[model samples]
Target: MTDPRQLAFAHRRSADQDRLQPAHHPVVIVGAGPVGLAAALGFAARGQASTVIDRKASLSDGNRAICWSKRTLEIMDRLGAAEALLDKGVTWRTGKVFLDDRLIYTFDLLPEAGHRMPAFVNLQQFLFEHYAIEAAKRTGLVDLRWQEDVTGIEPTTDGALLSITTPVGSYRILADWVIAADGARSTLRRLMGLGFEGRVFADQFLICDIHIKMDRPVERWFWFDPPFNRGRSALLHRQAGDVWRLDFQVGSEADRDAEVKPENVAKRVRAMLGEDIDFTFEWISLYRFQSRRLKRFRHGRVLFAGDAAHQMSPFGARGGNSGVQDADNLVWKLDLVLRDQAPERLLDSYDAERIPAADENLLNTTRSTDFIAPKSMASRILRDGVLALAASEPFARRLVNSGRLSVAATYDGSPLNTPDGFTAGDCPTTRPGAAALDAPLSDGWLLAALDRGFTSAWFCAEGISADALARMEAASARTTLPVKPLIVSDATACTRYGAASTPACFLFRPDGYIAARWRSIPPDAIAAALARATGR
Candidate 1:
């Protein structure tokens, strides 16, 4: 059997190459990696079309980002790619932390059991891109042009003009909006003369992907000062296809070439997995840690997402997961703007919300890096002491940070969110500016029922009253923006939203975040909240 990672996508010539004039598109996405692809699919979900361009003719190689968070999976589920990923990825929730050879503590990311998606899934980046590509194709709204390099960019009064190069020749294209999803070394960022502002750690880490026949439980295991690599930290994760990813904290002084050498990597693997265990090398690479991001995500007609906007240490699995969420947050706003349903100022909210999100990820990843690879003796001592006490002390265990895994970011003070109307009994998890919490309904999941649109979730114990239902129907009929009305009588879902006793109606944005909630459906309040949510 051939390795799926080695498969290359064919690059066919596009009609744009033969255009007499610059072809115009409503949206153009640079770099068809996971972020760009997801953005295209997101726009498509809102009845918008996009053109995606990538310099590479093939999907990413190697096992790049392997951990997909539940929030990310939910977003992908909305984009129609989650089922394939869930089928092929390893689902895990429990993680064990170790101090040397002794187990310190165990943690479960998702302790509750009502959600549809798992806590985390381990799948290769290539496979993720593959599934997203298929989803994009199914929408028929994405025009993917591989091996097309963006060479120049000119911001216009209404849009931007892009100079692209292909094997045949160069051509120009115009887009009302351009999304820069090109990786950390972004050509678009350079052309715009923008630079990232943050810290770059001196420590380096070595990643080794090995295939072996072993029966290890699907769980995250992190070690501090283990026997295999004394004085250094290590992480172990199980991936699909019997592949295991091992990350060892090799010091800054280690030679990049020497560390990745098969013999040297094998030596480290043998020490960790016992010399008797047989394994074959799949991939090996070394990376330096950095927690940096662009000062802003939006620049007039151009917007940045993924590595192009921010970068952080990989320990937390925040980089890829957060990038996908960036697409989720952006597309709905962009779609509304394109359709003239919202003011242009709504785009500013994307910067307002996502910048803080990037900062949060950077802060947490930086702290994780500092704890995992302490720079000074005092810091190392503090980390070690905390690890030692974590075995028995519950409070001390809270101090342990082995890449504080990725979680959905809450836009606590976003301008788009309306203040909660309920005096009490509102669910904290589904409060204004927070992502909608997934819960089990009588027929399907809450999120699936919400779908990809503005929703008015009416939670009541004995079903919606005729008066309330008639009011909600009238409100929906009056609004230009379609709001799908969902009547939830499920006990679990009603309790989750704090609508068991007091009937509540929660207005959700297209991105699945709470916009506003009311004790009863009021036509005027719904109109005002919708106006505020869309920046009218």
Candidate 2:
């Protein structure tokens, strides 16, 4: 068949313009992928306009990243694209693991009820990007310049100077800040001579997306040393549009080009299916696993995010999810600093917070990679033994590492969080520096009540002192900074949030991470916490 990538482009082409005119923008993003577009939307949500430049003429064609975690969906929701994505995506909460065609175990993600988003959604990366691109366009705050390639990046005294080459010609842009959301092969990272250090595994993995009519349940299926392929691992996941993604552990010795050929791909599919089954190949690619990251994400005014800041093996589905989180973490800080609501020093916290997150993702992916692709014969033997024991032993089942999947990375030691001083019998569902857990409220979930800035949640009894309420309201009205006060009246909400004790309060940052909590509503204490949260 015909290559889908060669078809007519869907995005608007860049029009010719005068090259000598230099442009200036508050923020210029050097990539239009999901992460970059989401970053633009993040800025747009905060009334910050950004220009998004991408080398590609349109969204990607293949199904690159298929799994989006709950936190990612929340970030998309904040950007106004989550509903659109959920409508077009396939939602799955169950997974099955097998050892050589023998069923080892089955697990369910157990998505919580009343939460605004599910645990995970399986959608093609291209389709998600399409949704993001359209959302960015609707905002009118994002200037998306397609076919614009960023060739050079120079850190300026104020921010950064970027050299962009488009179909018209090369042009220079001066911006107060620049975000490099470019993918793994980031042009800005390369031009800046940044080093991404890590390990490269020896095994090669082949990913194929096929359009076929299959009765397989909507769940993740992972096989170790399956009958179709001896001594190799395989993964099968269902995507929307009746497309299925299959991954095979093709050893390093296999030729990459030969493995992706239609005949070779057909041979592998035929092995999985019987001689009578029918399927059409949509896309195929070969990739080797790697865990690498930059030492720091912020270099002067140019901030790196997504695959540009960190790279990890795909075993955990952390690649895209973590990238989206990176965007989420940086945008709020960028907005704060740009709006002068927070000091420039506040930007350093982005590095401190997200670097650790990247490290955690790298560690998880590394463990999954080691488990899936044992380095030595002894290791492989141990792996097989564990798999064998997992079939019968309950304890061994916990040790099986088919792919840890993705979850929200907590900023345990984040400097932005105000430590909880007052204690209760139960732990607060949302801890300091942890992503706020969604809970059913009287009208909506807790996440929906949060603002884009600092939100102070006051859980009080039916009748509160008017003086105390006045103090809290006065603190909220102090500035134009993104700060809001929310009161929880229902007793169920108070109990569920572990704030049943009268006057319990929780402070959350714009990204939904809890910044601080108080057992009693103290006007002075809340003001101090907000001051520190905004880098006062």
Candidate 3:
């Protein structure tokens, strides 16, 4: 005989799922955060359908992230949302660090000819989410279902099944693939039994968005001292116009309940002003820095991006930037799989490449955090010494500012990224050893061959040969690059971007960066690069 208790428990479990005939799709993204939205837009960019589900009842109301890196801005530019963000956000080229009212370090992002974009852009996270949501809506490919709570996840041979409970009813969604960008406490990650391992900073921090009545230029200012609070630090960042993001170190020994109080937060901000800042506090919250990353970003059909994959301290503003990069790495593979352009082997590169980038950023962020908020006397002394050196030396300042770094995904051993005639140390730029990260990508394969007047942003050099003409024709039939085989005959233009003499070929990726450049364009290499970038 079956026990009534067991039967009831099973029924309750099924009821929690509240599914209605399991919906099916090519891909399902859990969470409508910036990363999930970026993934959705990626699907649209590749002409695929994705269903994004989020538990949030409404959009983010607070200032979560106010700093955007150059790479992220470029991505938004491609997605057709940068216009709105740029119009509202402030621009800053320099970041200054002050130790007890004395300038200790000043770093400038606008360097002399190295990168395609600057180190950072100051904007609120709400504006970021607002624009991403609007851009995703225009795509007409994403089915964003908010107020939908995921209760269970079940994987199948074809894909995985998601059981979600909405306010209206329950439903099941079958997805060819699933991405988890559901923040630190990700339900999808937990359901998959994935682990996030790292250290949580012992110090507590108070973050507040205040409308201070002051006339300060659009620049990021950081103060490291107890002048405002004993043994603590403060950061003031401009978000759009009057709204500013201010973070005050609440001390390790401070009571959490007292620190989170709005009155106490105002008191701290006022203290920083000495007399009175006369600021209206918008929102106040307490948080701590952590150095944690997931062991694996992928688990069969379920993939992780953004905070789901890892979480680092916001010292260098690495979290959202890394999350956007995660989307960039993933979207291409998903598009390829959807179009059947490449084998599933291509998807393997996502974890291999992105995990390393995440780990690298993790280390840099932790070091910066430790340097700023040292716990021990010895560590503090060492940090002060380094800060002093950075204040005086331009090289040291550049190194310190390099932590707010951005990069493109370069899968060294991935089958997609070929090992052609391009030598290992043959980097064409000065981007601090991470060549691919700093380099810009084109729409598709770029063949830079100087024939008479070889010219094209992506591909250059075409000759009188029938085969070369045929190769251009073949390229036109497959990729999205405007000039598949443009015939450039301008000598002056050839030397501008720094290319070899005539008859050289350079294949470009969809993001407009040179992927494979050689002495001459090989037919097979051209076809492979096109296939990799376009997924068709």
Best prediction by lDDT: 1
Predicted structure 1: lDDT: 0.90
lDDT of each: 0.90, 0.84, 0.68
Residue pairs with backbone atoms closer than 3 Å in model 1 (clashes): none
Query: Considering TM-score, where higher is better, how would the candidates rank from best to worst?
Result: 1, 2, 3
- Mark the 10 consecutive residues where model 1 has the least summed lDDT: 1-10
List runs of model 2 lying over 4 Å from the truth.
1-21, 422-429, 460-471, 474-482, 489-492, 500-503
The whole-model C-alpha lDDT of candidate 3 against the native structure comes to 0.68
Reference-based lDDT, residue 87, model 2? 93
Model 1 ranges off by over 4 Å? 424-426
lDDT of model 2, residue 31:
83
lDDT of 3 by residue, 45-78 (tens): 7778888888776666577877888767767665
- What are the per-residue Cα lDDT tens digits for candidate 1 across 136-242? 99999999998899999999989999999988888999999999999888999999999888888889899999999889899999999999999999999999899
Index of the highest-TM-score prediction: 1
Candidate 1 root-mean-square deviation in Å: 1.3
